[model samples]
Target: MKILHLDKNHPLLFEQLSQLGFQNDEDYTSSKEEVEAKINNYEGIVIRSRFDIDKTFLDAAKNLKFIARVGAGLESIDVEYAESKNITLIAAPEGNRNAVGEHALGMLLLLFNNLKQADSELKQGLWNREANRGTELDGKTVGIIGYGNMGKAFAKKLRGFEVEVLCYDIKENVGDQNAKQVTLEELQEKTDVLSLHIPWTEATDKMVNASFISKFKKPFWLLNTARGKCVVTTDLVQALKSGKILGAGLDVLEYEKGSFESLFTGNDLPEALQELMKMDNVLLSPHIAGWTVESKEKLAQVIVDKIKQLYGFGDDEKKILPPKEYGVSGLGGFFFKTKDPDHIKAWYKEHLGMNTDQYGWTFWWKDKEGNDCSTQWSPFKEDTNYFAPSEKPYMMNLRVKDLHKLLNQLKEEGVTVVGEVEEFSYGKFGWILDPEGNKLELWEPNDRAFL
Candidate 1:
């Protein structure tokens, strides 16, 4: 299977992929038209944020199978479109989770110990040992939000620091044996320091707003190695001014592009950011928490392993490449909605040969061969709002070998495949609406690279 490396940057990734036996096309800096023209010839494509994979690109690709992103975050990729096209998407956040954790810890240590200030003073030939005091991490309660890979790594590192770690995540069952699982309120009430590891989701944008910060019981040290927009800079500045927050170790800031360089020379400073810059207690750095030499190599390996698993490639044939995008992957239970749960369950059982269980009229089916096969379906009230948009239901994509054939089979079995076959640069795919108007995507790739 032919694989095309789209971006010219990240030489280490190219070197790793060369050892995997997959042929790489060297015309890395292709324009949109060039990529669209040649994408159909390749089975696999690795990208960075340099190119945007929109509907046009998806429609143009006839053989594109898998997309490997080298870092964390999917803000640049058209995830829905790729899934609809049946393109397997993989990312390498596992490689950098530890890096982020260590960076956060290092920044916090520097802040609490006044290391940056001391370094500056020493450079000026001052010997004020008495004034340069420091604090200890021992016996402190640290609150961590978004208990995913990065959050878990941070917790692991804190184990030897003699600190109590409290974690609060929207999803349950993330508690580790070492850290205490607590609600947001509880964490806010007890923490001496707070670190954010959450993603940039709709619910998490500006999550650390004014009211959110007001819940803290003490003047806590704040750390944000996550996305910049997660914290409201205005609210943080107010908190700092009011002595509600002792200090902040920030790797990101809202509108940081302007502050990082003198590019916007004449522009007015946002009131909040201007105030933040004047505070000595605040320690700021550009976003580099997950950027380390070791992490870069690790990210490549993680992406390579994911691609190998997705395509059922042999260990010897697996190739490591730096990714251009990043996202989360794991087995997750989904809540489906249907007008007639029983009928849908029966259809899946009879046509798809799926194993399903019912609770009242609702039915749930788990992939027979998967670990979590004991899935169930239950009835809901006629007016039940559980499937409503307000619940923010998840969209599941079932990867199929041949989307057209699968659609035909479902159609023959009296199931409605809602959408027409949409052709994209990546591949051809379609969608179907369940009994409750919930949309599920079916993808089929035209290449063997994603076998």
Candidate 2:
């Protein structure tokens, strides 16, 4: 099989793929037209974020079978469109999970211990060790937002620090024996620090808003290694001004496109962001939390392994198997089962303007502007048989066109959509739940919408 490597210069990945007996070609940089022109020749395309993989590219890749992302985020690839064309999508979060987790931990420690102040003082020939005393993590309570691969890695690192870890995720009962499961409210009340590890989604974008920060009874440290727009910068700045939060360690900023040094210069920033940079309590990085040297090589190896697993290239040679129950498949979306299908369907129909049939077999919905809302379902028993222990009711995200209008309509219809309608660097979305206690997500894409 022919493999096309889009963003060249990864010698490790090149050597590894060569050893796998696959013919590989390097393209240091390819224009949209050029890549599309030759896409049909390769069976697999490996890329970073340099090139966009949209419908046009997918249409040209007649021989394409798999699209391997050398990094974690799939935001650059049109995943849904690729899946529709029966192309497998693969990402390597496992490779950089440790790197990101460690970076987040390092930022938190540096901010709390006032390491930056010490470095500044020492450089200027001053000693203020007593004034720059550090805080202890031994008896602290940390709240982790997302419980995915990165979240697990962060929790594992926190285990060595002897701190109590509480996690709140939309996915129910993600009970790690090491950490306690708690509600968002409990996390706000008891946590000494709150770390965000969620993806950029409708439910998570601008999640740390005014009300979210105001809900905290104690001044807590905030850490976000996730997407930049995960926290509302304006509201976080307000919190910092009023001292509602003790401090913040941010690896990603709200609008980070240009070089880090250029973006943070003098007064050419949003008023709220300008004030934030002046605060010694806030620590910021250039979204390099997961870009360690070791992680780069490991990410390449991880993607190569995923490619091998997809084709069953070497069964005799040991390989890191994917989750046993959830093998890779075309994203026909996910399967969800509700015990009270009728009640759930009716709730969705009445509140969220969804349409349901008499037999409760199929369901549909329209946004306020009358766009078709994608929907799907299967029998509860059948789904349980397929997706065992994870049979609990959870949210299923439906792609939508107008997020704001739908959120307002749901509010008018007496449905308590969890959060406000907000735009992110990635997309726009909102959240709501059905009567049977299943969360529902609505999303509207933006630039880099595929991920």
Candidate 3:
């Protein structure tokens, strides 16, 4: 099958897909019409908000089987029409949910502590503590709209805070222990902070307008990491002016272009957005709530995994890279020392889609002959003795087939062997030293059992 890439992503997305025998091409600078003119040539396409995949585009894609969007939302694509044509719309909400969660939390904390304002004042040499005094999140009620992957993630981040979390979603039974399910009316009545996490649907377009804001019993801070069109910008500005809304932290804005790559393409900024820019209490960012370095790679990986799964091609079903008959096949794992191992692990797992646990990330692939393989990525405590005998800050674990045989060969060649063979259910491990005295780990893996 031929796949067209409308927007570039991490190389792994292409690399992995190409490994599945798919012919891939990139057309980053082509117009939508130009792409449509040649759409029938490809069986699939990968995108990340470069342009809309409307009915017209779908109609032109006669042979297209799937549209794999590297990002979460499919609003830019005509989902209904695509589905009606039997085209699979693949979205990677799972990929960036954690990044969105962390970003929302950061924005909320910045607003609550007046951190942005305080930092600006300090930089300008205007330190007025009383004027910049902030509210505490500990006693507040945080109401989350649309309790899907993104909403649940934001609520989970609030677990450390002494705040009540309420979620309102059209889907029932979505409330978890981190947040209580509540009606929209009840949430409006009690929430001190309202976070929007819904998609851009007809029901949500301009959903948070004057009527919506007026229904709230008291003023509340607003956080929107969702679609910009969900909130009416003029109404939001009016609420901010009237103090009906204490403040707003918006990562997306109504004035954004369809592509979300530029805000106002060679045009003057809208009046409402201009007003928003001048407000000290308002915090704004580009549509980047989920645009973290880690998320870039994760999003690509998710799209790759989904595409592979869709076509019955996957890590366990095929070889990730060709294996050697003798010697190290590839890098088995990578480990490092960190001051905060737990936090590091959580960060990697959340932002990088590592799925790291107590031990760390176990990457699954396959060797030739379709045998499952595993590679580990982990971080240890700063003062740990894990990298013992050698004071190196890191270790390189190499995957080999015959650990004992290789160790014997190295010993005959006068190479230093650091340890005896250690066997486990998943694998056998042995340590050796390089000429420069840096310790290296060798693993004879039983990957099918390890997984």
Clashing residue pairs in all predictions, respectively, total: 20, 2, 0
Off by over 4 Å in 1: 8-12, 26-38, 256-271, 315-451
Using lDDT as the measure, what is the rank order of every candidate, best first?
A: 3, 2, 1
lDDT assessment of candidate 1: 0.75
* C-alpha lDDT values of all predictions: 0.75, 0.77, 0.90
Q: How many residue pairs of model 2 clash at the backbone?
A: 2
Candidate 3 Cα errors over 4 Å, as ranges: 314-451
lDDT of 3 by residue, 144-223 (tens): 99999899999999999999999999999999999999999999999999999999999999999999999999899999
Looking at candidate 1, the ten consecutive residues that score lowest on lDDT are 322-331
Best by lDDT: 3
Instruction: Report clash pairs, candidate 2.
Output: 74-451, 75-451
Q: What TM-score would every model get versus the actual structure?
A: 0.64, 0.66, 0.71
Number of the top TM-score candidate: 3
Q: Residue 307 lDDT in model 3?
A: 84
